[model samples]
Target chain A: MAHADMDTQRLDLPEPMPQPRFQAGFITPYAFIFPALLVMLGGLLYPVFMAMYLSLYDWQIGLDLEDAPFVGLTNFSRMLTDPQVWEVLWVTMRFGFWTITIEMTLGVALALLLEKPIRGASVFRTIFILPLMVSPVVVGLIWRYLFDARVGWINYYLGAWFGIEPQIWLGDAQLAFFAIVFTDIWQWTPFIFIIVIAGLQALPSEVVEASTIDGANWWQQVFLVKLPMIKSILVIALLMRLIDVFRGMEVMLIMTGGGPGRSTELLSLHIYNRAFETQQLGYASAISVLLIVIVFAISTLILTMANPMKSRSDV
Target chain B: MTGLFKKGVGALAALTMSTTLAFANPYEKYEGTTIVVSWPALSHFIKAEELIEEFTEETGIEVEVDALQYLKLRDRQLLEMSKDEGEYDVVSWVVMWKGEYVSKGLLTPLSQFYTNGSLVDPNYDINDIADAYLQNGGIVGGHKGYMPGKSGAMYGVPFGAETSILAYRKDIFEEQGLEVPETYDELRDVMAKLHAAGIPALTSRGKTGHQVTAGWLLHLAPLGGKIFDDNWNPVINSPEAVEAAQVMREVVKTGPAGIPTFGFGEAAAAFLQGEAAMHLDTLKIAAMSRDPKLSKIDGKVGYALHPVGSRCGSETGGFAAGIPANSQNKEAAFLFLQYITSKAGDQRMVELGGDPVRISTLQNNTEGFDEYPVVAEQLPCADPDWRPLIPEWNELNIDVLGQALTQVITTDDPIQPIMDAANEKARAIMEREGYYVWQ
Candidate 1:
């Protein structure tokens, strides 16, 4: 066999063919991953870099490229002085705070209330989650028509069924803020509810049974045992809501158009208005940059509170 | 494994295909090919796109339509011109950016088109166009502005024009023992009566910026405040202007419940559905308010000028179209703009929601005009101030006016602060643009 193999060597050199730098393992893995890395860098990282770069320049979107006068941090400084910017930010924060707080409270309550498989609980759960499925714009439009002072179904009832003054739901600043907050809570509470309910269901029966054996009441069980166990899930849910809160201006833009006085003007809507309507592209970009920072900082805080990586590894 | 790889590649390819961004048309060929013109979110552009097939048959040119928002369109215009790149052959510039659009080195001069007597399609008369529109408005960016086009250096000729007229519910007016308010005082009295009757008198502005600026502020401020001085310092936010804004606030109080929250579309809907007793807008909405297809109160609408204060007249708010300096099809775009601006185009629009400025259109009694006496006389009666050329106007209107208007309309806060802020901003913007900027 050795003699036959030696004969079959043909024209082999004494040093033999040098092995490739990497056998299939290292090279093959990178070959598999390179396209993905390229995509991440190109799509996500590039835009972020561009947005940050643009934030520094006094740039208009459609103006001459040569015309972007670099104003250093003046755009950012102007934003700090701009009352409208701060007002819009305040509106956004209030909107986010109300929507998330109410949503979280109601969501947990509903999930706990319905966790027990009672008659028609499934149907009720299905109905509860339905509003979340509808598009935000559709939701806004529906609410808009419903809230119309003259023609809305809401006003019709106020006029006919009850002797209530027709509230300008989308007009007066306070009412408009409440209207947006209520609309958001109505749509998003189900998301929290669904997550919490799932977390409740996943709890070990032994833990529950042990709690029952200890003569702990239902309220105590929920607050003490169940809530502590599902804190991480709750945190995740809150984090998601926080992300959405930053981007919550679309519904307001459609419903109220950021009007009756910048009452409903959230940061996002303000940025959009400045960018498109005003053509102050540089100012708009700076605001957009601020918005990104705000959203990122808030999101980071929320995520760190949950620390899913830390919590999940232990679990 | 091969199939998986192929599927991944295909998915990536599809993603790339879907997002192929619009690029400059390098080809300057103007064969029997059709090109499209567009306006910011109006129905005319939609119809224009639909008619491309017919145009293709007659002219053998391929055309398409693009309907963008007003701000988006303006941005597109500046960008396309800066690159001197043409992607479209026609554009809709109704009553838009002022004559300085010609002076700013942005547009191609149509003086040659005018001299050649090919200014319009033969079926359309060149004489019928309002003289002011031709003389004053036709200038832009240091050139004698040509009519609006899809691409080229020329600005767009109006495909349509809009001047706000009072739209009132006839039933409510009759029941309230009121005639259409012809003057500001009468409008006030009539609106108060309507308010007493528990009917919303108007559908005021909230969502959109220009809606209130044009429909409300421009209307009242011109009547009360000094409109255009000998020196073109716009003092529309003067004490008189404040009085007018206050009047608007008071008047808007009687409008639909969410009036301050309403944009044009909502306001129109509210009026058409008999929610608002009156709406102040152009004849363009006359068709919509009359169309049984959409309007609930079709033919139940009436018209009059928005109540004038001390002044004898009204200001105009109209869109304009222009070609980008970089258009690949300059000649074709120019032809398209001229064609659309001519009588034939106006008449065609007359059948649709066209607000014709041609004398012939008003004289001929277009379809809806014969039904209403005011329509017959209205087109010619409109005041012309598509006004003195202002360069910094883009910033003035969009940044200064729009911002203040939004602040006022949306929040019921101090109008003074917003107005003052706007005035300051407007001054800065105007000064930046090298206009006569007063502190």
Candidate 2:
């Protein structure tokens, strides 16, 4: 009886049920989509599958793929066993953690602090988001030049004011990692800040008023009311940052070239070196497959944490 | 609201897809079609574009040249080629990609083009190109895989190749009354004198890993040492190599501040800007001297063989180009390949402030720079093949030389400790990489 009722309701809807909105292409629906879909299938899907296939072979970039003897699971096994891969992964995770944590906390806190319509607040907000607007590569180059041991502005100030020796920002292993993290935070915190402000602006005001009515103090209102309401938006901001962290090779590659030792090598940079510089295509592909898996798992975890019921409305 | 959010995400991804797929057809009646030629971001390529109008007039192919530094360019080209898109018909590359690309059937084998005599001018002889330059930039593996086209074959083409030559300020030598140092002892003597004069003799080492590593190896090579032996075994700890290291460590006392973090750009800049009086660099800088825009030294540059430590030799480094085997327009690619690497192209490049590898271009009596003394004097012995012709050299470089050279300049650590660490690490890398290890 329930099913029949649902079917009757469906029939009562608009004629042809709006022709299945966003349908795949050809003739009835835009035929242009067919060409576009085929392109995606060929360009995106094929590379993905080929990457998986290549992971089974001992492939080199300049060597014949046919000559690459198939060694199923060995490439994956090698990647798993390699200490350097793990080292890079751990460094990347730590990097991601530090940047994301600092950016998110400071970003959200600053957004909340600046939400008041104070004098010159608009100017401060504009300037805060400006860093986000600059291209990441340009930001990297600017920072790299500023941090140069000999000619950098940072060292100049440090030397002139503090009587400190000019530090090798990108030449020391630990320093390079910190330098990249610092650069990333400097450029990207604004992204988190802007998103948080937007989230704050759209939030309903009645809840805060109601919390006040319940005798909640400022901290109480923020912790017990506003934060819960914005929890979902926070997840979205986290998702974007996590993705950027995984794939941001440009700044790191340009700034440090994954050097002073492999100390600053993020997974993406490592994959780049393996695929091109070292010419180990199969190994790089395998590494990327694992990366995709890791990213997917993390996203899933974050999504689940954000939405307990897996409900779309939570985000 | 839910539908809107999903649509927005879908639309953004779709937008990214459309742009990437939107490669302009090069043969589109010579109108809006744009062909992207990927290359190293070195100013040399940009310098050549000043003459691109001539190419456009002759061929009617609208060109949009894009460049990135070579390492990133290599990464981008590899990733892009693996997709098998016909987006770029021509891309700048080094010889390393030839073996892999040819075997994977991703690079065009230039043999057929040469056999037919249709792609290249018939007057071009196979021997016109120096054998050393061709071998260094030729096919990587023991396969007839890819040709860079201009050197009488077409899988790829030479893009203004030049060997690494030691560079120093002529005025420095004259002021100090030092003859251009050719041997290690002479270089040491010069360094000792400069140290006594307190002008910071050697350019900083360990600035950028590759920059420091590259020059240092060339410095060490003339000492009759190499990072690896013929079997790809790591033998950098040879007595000659150690002696080379010891001298480098001592010479580095005269290195500039922050020596650990300097790159070729800084090192060369220091030399050219008259900050560092002596620098071992490349012959391509010869173009820099005569050009008013690039020259920091006005009539103050002098050149010689990279100082010989034990006298094996200096190294060669330059750019090469390859046509993907799976390119949709193979014939068009070959034609562009030949055009770019042709004697005319090379000569024009030199005219446009580029370094030329071809003797014919160097010997071009018509060009204005031929009157410059360095151009005439240095062209004869500018041989390449100083860097070994091995596909594995790139790895050997990053693992072996890249690591050690950084240490050689940074710490006051003994040369023996650093060389030992490098040798041990290098051997394991070679063995693990499936090379013939000297047990």
Candidate 3:
């Protein structure tokens, strides 16, 4: 057998046989993905398209869609000059900035603190994620109760523990804005904490150990090695929250109803008020188109930063 | 023998006719038909729901009620009525929304049903319902800004009518030697004294949107403020309106610490929980004030008519029931409406914590009337045209005036500029809605 193998190796091998370009039916791949594509079209694209379509008409509530007068681009042009729209857009941006900044910072710090197995760590982790489990509407109510100017636990403790005067947390515009921001942080930090901690725990221990052996300090290890490795996860979490900031309005709607001169009125809540409160369905749809574009641009910009096709080692 | 037979046959025929007429059932034709009613989830509606089984048994018609939040009912009704096949057989008509609904041809004129002897109960006297509530709930095509005018058509039946009244802590008033204020000046003085004494004086809704406007509009008519003049020009910044605004500011400033953020719930809580001295709002709050389970100062609460400003005027409007034009079960729906608004039905509602729009029911139901005698007294003062019931009112009252009222209550910004800006905005809305087409 050895002699035969040596003889065969000495001879040149024939050129490889040509392979067929197609192995299966052309429709098979598309068939596999048809359901998902259909879902995206139905669930995501359809509503957006409908909003754009509705934006072209001068529609009021109780009017048939077919009977609605077509005032092409008028609704869009009106929204451009609507002060309320601009005010609420600015409010949403400010809200997004404060909430995302604090939530990311606090969430990462908490995840890092509890990623290791420590005494009562599980209990603390459980308690931290409890706020995430609560419904957003319920969270709004709970926080509204806490922030009540009179007979609230927050005021009571602030006075009892310190000698501070009670304040109407939801009355003043600035204070109301701050109150909504604080509530968002309390409810959402846990979400970020859960995601970040999962990412942290899943990290390869060998690289961390190597960093430790190379005499890198704890802060250096976190900043240079650990955080850099989880940058993609952090960006994704942030993008999710940023989109949420644009989309969510239940908390603000319940807490302030965009009160004290529209100070706490987020963009989504403003859209709601425009549509239902004012019965300007067409104008509201136009504003909603603006929201979709803003969210799309934000998501695109953030996704580019993450480079999902590349691995951490490639970075 | 022939004469005796003829007399006997005539006698038998007359006897059978009289018996059949006496025992006729008005609800027989609608039996087995099911209707869907969209109503607000208020206290009275919940209680009225318990009596629906009896209605079903008597008529053999099924009722499927969708009890939604009071504010949400309109949105639901609007969408439902817009559809080719309406989801609700009977929809609630908030008084302010009647203009839009009637003008848009969404509701059936109930006069058609009332004129049908076979459909309407003979004993169901529409006149028994209080004129103020009936006019506000039923009439349409009246002069602009006026609800009941020279002539109109009936479109709905008032099921849950209400008016603004004052609820005060009797214990506190007696202790402070405060008399029941009968005028705006007296009320302001009383509130100031109560505030100066370190007590939360007045509790009223100040949250933005319909709530704030509803609270402030209570003073608008009494203070001689009109949203528009005869020429359809915006008059919200008139001197009387400015005074009303001032009165509103004082009420909020001197009230509980969280008054600026108070909705109906918070305002009612402030009074019911013994945190405030007085509350001037819906009669439902007064009714709830007497419930021991709900109110901390239940027995100690006293009710009074709203104080007079320029002239006596109180906020009057509430839920009414009407069949949508597209409703599939219109006959059944109309029968259900007539049944629930009959004298017996109104009395049952009054017994079950509901306000009555019927004069006979209000007079007859004296068993638990001592707690809220102001309900009767305030009826005459509740001007049906208190707020303009135009299609543009929703935007003007809620988005424009509501925000202005919030600004007034929350900030020290000069009231004149805020009100003038509100007036300008109102003018813009009115003009856009074609109110000033002549101009």
Ignoring the other chain, what TM-score does chain B have in each prediction? Answer: 0.77, 0.81, 0.93
Preferred candidate (lDDT higher): 2 or 3: 3
lDDT of 3 by residue, B1-439 (tens): 9999999999999999877855686676777999999999988888898668879988889999999998888888988898889888998878888888988889998878877878878788887887788878778887773366666777888888888888888899999999989999999999999999999899988888888888888888888888888888989999999898898899987898888888888989988999999989888886787788878987788888889988998887887889999999998999889889998888878777778888777667666675345677778888888888887888888779988988998888899999999999998888877877886
Cα RMSD for candidates in order = 13.0, 14.7, 4.0
Q: B125, model 2: CA deviation in Å?
A: 7.7
- Cα lDDT tens digits, model 2, B310-415, are 5535554576776675555556666666666677777777767776656666666433553234433443443343444455666667756776766776566777
lDDT of 3 by residue, A1-315 (tens): 998998898765776778768657877999989999999999999999999999999889888888899999999888998888888999999999999999999999999999999999999999999999999899889988999998789889999999889989998889999999999999999999999999999999999999999999999999999998898889889989999999999999888888777899999999998898888899999999999999999899877767544655575
What TM-score would candidate 2 get against the native?
0.74
Which of the two candidates, 2 or 3, achieves a greater DockQ against the reference?
Answer: 3
Candidate 1: tens digits of C-alpha lDDT, residues B215-312: 45545544556434544556656776666666567657777766665667777777777778887765566778767876998767767655666764
Candidate 3, what DockQ? Answer: 0.70
**Weakest 10 consecutive residues of candidate 2 chain A by summed lDDT:** A306-315
Top candidate, metric lDDT: 3
* Model 1: fraction of native contacts: 0.56
Scored by DockQ, the top model is: 3
Q: Which of the predicted structures, 1 or 3, would earn the higher lDDT when compared with the native? A: 3
1 or 2: which has the higher lDDT? 2
TM-score of 3: 0.93
Evaluate model 2 with DockQ and give the value: 0.18
How badly does each model clash, as a count of residue pairs?
51, 23, 0
